[model samples]
Target: MRDLRIGIIGVGVMGADHAERVVRRISGARLVAVSDPDLPRATTLAESLGSSSAPAAGTGDGDAIRVIEDPLALIGNAEVDAVIIASPGFAHAEQLMACLEHGKPVLCEKPLTMDTESSLRVVEAEHKLGRQLIQVGFMRRFDPEYAALKQLLDSGELGRTLLLHNVHRNKTVPESFRSEMIVRDSLVHEVDVARWLFDDEIARITVRAPKPTGLVADGVLDPQLAVFEMASGAIADVEVFVNFQVGYEVRCEAVAEKGSATIGLGVDVLTRRAGHWGGAVPDDYRARFGTAYDIEVQRWVDATARGEIDGPTAWDGYAAAAVCTAGVQSLQEGRPVEVEMARRSEVLG
Candidate 1:
């Protein structure tokens, strides 16, 4: 099996996890290079991946992983057959465009970009290239349960989905977090789910806040609700609570004509003890979607090896960002805002 050399930008939690997954768990790919503004963090991740500090050409005693100073350079590295943009949202658009320029397959984490216009630029770039080279890392679509639900809906046995109820909760947020992140960061997953499940675009968004739990960091909103009107005439609502302090939970229930289906129960392990029934609650996103992440990466690697993108497209990312942008506008303006999405390319269409 020829290895697909993968370079990852941003050695944060998600980036590090991806590197480790590529090195240890996933097949058909190898972590060849990593970059971060914090050089030490990148070096530390490279070392832990059983790779020594060596250039792509310089082989140490083990599989040496190169440390690139600039993410743009990482994209152009001769050894990097693919790029994974785990960097911040502000950096995503440029790096994605770089991938298109370098003609490398890229797996970009969400937001694609901070706003609709930036995401559209990537869409335009991919369309101009006339190939599918970018796959947005919307991991839930790979989850077994989520996949089952989607298959159920596609089977048409449940009839047309009329409503989708989603819940996303976290134990807490960092001090740097802001109220708008409730829509930008957390509920954005639901935005993608709405698109993936309903196979339509978001037409409208309405945001509501019902007081903060105060358990979260100061100046950050604890909980928020955003309702969506899908272009397919289906509706979806997401409840995002980041300071519930219990555990991380992501769930969705779709109500259709014949019946309903639900996923994301905190059922890692269900037990009966102390005269009570109990189940384990995931501590964070990693615990909640661990399996999904593995499957997502594996599928991406396999598809990239086949010269194809197997997950969410650049268009999916752009539409999700458009919906999230409208969600933020609704949050600020205290009213429903229509999503501003324009398909500028037939490839994306």
Candidate 2:
């Protein structure tokens, strides 16, 4: 079989990383085209990958990679068989619709869309197409540690998990990163984790914050607490601290009737110094979850070659947006808010 011809939209941090991965690391796929609002950035990435990279096995060399000025044109490009959307959240809905219209499979980076309604619209469109054509980029599901935890939970070894505790910390944030972004961007991962691990929907949510870290200005909750009540009678509490100033760290612990399991305590080699014993914390998420991203993209490439999606779907994206909607509302109102979501059957049908 010929290598899957992949085009990536958005050459920002995540998009550029994905483009390099496709050209250099991933098998059964080749980077053929890229598009972004910043034409110079996209052109630079395309030229660099096209000129320097060797073709993957089974994919003959000398395929010309181009920079399409429009993301929709990239989606509709004849040589492009699939698309990876690393664009901003606000741009996702339109680009996703274009992919569906062109019958191109997509691996859209998180947020799926900025809000629940647009996300559901994508779901509805794909459902009407009579196939699953979109996969939301929830990379954590592909992480080895998280996958192991999931397998253990599924095995009944954990014996009906009752509580899940997650800690999401970032070293810093851009000035443009607003307070609501803490819920929409960072904590959204925990929301999906809760739904995925428990195999249930979030029933209600409440947001509370302690004193803001002195480093953060007023009105921004540097560290916040979010409580999610799942439909399965389980609870998942997430502590999202964007200005932790230490390093990027994500930890999850599952408490079950029989026992408990914790992961993400830094898997690097431990050190025994003159007086200290410790391990290095990743400076950012890219350092921490690099392997997971590779696996996720490669799996998507493999599945799209077979006319299928191997990971989270558009409904999963919509559900995540639904929960985050309630979360942001709770954060604003300073009260517990019941999650409102349409049944899958209702929306898909």
Candidate 3:
């Protein structure tokens, strides 16, 4: 069988990483094309891989990869068998619709469409097709530690998970990263994790901001706390600090009826120096979750090759968007907000 011909949209940080992974690391796929609004960036990425990358199975031309100026054109390219969309969140809905129309499989980076309505539309469109073709890029589900924790929970070794505590800290963010983005971009992951780990929908959420860190602008909330009440009566709390001034750190501890376990402590390589003991901290998510991303794309490619999606679905994206929409409302109003969502059967059936 021919190797899966993959095209990537948005050659920014995440996109470029995935493109390189397809060329160098992943098996059963070849980077056939790339597209970005910035033509030069896309061209550079394609060229950078051209020499080191193997040409796709049927492309007899010496051209290893094509740089398409338009994302839709890239998606429609006959040489492209599957697509990886790392475009900005706002572009997801339209691009996803195009993928559905083309019958192409896509692995899309999250926010999934910036809002609940668009996400639901994508979900409905895919549902109408009677095929699962879209995979939301929530890479944590593929992480080794997270996978182990989930397995432990599923095995009944941890009994019933009662509470989950998450700590997400970033070194800093750009000035344009506003208050609500912390909830949308950073806390959204926790929302998905909570749903995944507990297997329950969030019933209500309340966001509370602590004193603003001097490092951020006046209106931006540097550190915030979000509490989630799940449908199963489990509680999950998140502490999100986007300008923590420390290395990137994401830690999660699950409290169960029998025991508790934590991950992401970065203690795998602890060191002892002249009366001091510590280990390296990841500079950013790219460093911390690099392995997870690799596993995620590889699995997606393998599944797409088999005409299936083996990851988070469009409904998962819509659910996360719904919770985050409520999270933003809670942040703004300083009150508990109920998560409004359509019943799964109502949407899927």
Tell me the TM-score of each prediction against the true structure.
Answer: 0.94, 0.97, 0.97
lDDT of each: 0.86, 0.90, 0.90
Q: Which ten residues in a row have the lowest lDDT in candidate 2?
A: 53-62
Worst 10 residues of 1 by lDDT: 52-61
lDDT of 3 by residue, 122-209 (tens): 9999999999999999999999999999999988997999999999999988899999899988998999999999989999999999
Output the worst ten-in-a-row residue range by lDDT, candidate 3.
53-62
Model 1, 123-146: lDDT tens digits are: 988988878999998999998899
**lDDT tens string, model 2, 240-324?**
9999899999999999999999999985689899999998988889988999999999899889888899999999999999999
**Off by more than 4 A, model 2:** 57-62
Clashing pairs for predicted structure model 2, backbone only:
none
Residue-level error in angstroms, candidate 3, position 127: 0.4
Candidate 1 lDDT at 61 equals 28
Once fitted onto the true fold, the runs of candidate 3 whose alpha carbons sit more than 4 angstroms away are 53-63
The reply for model 1, stretches above 4 Å from the true place, is: 51-61, 344-349
lDDT of 1: 0.86
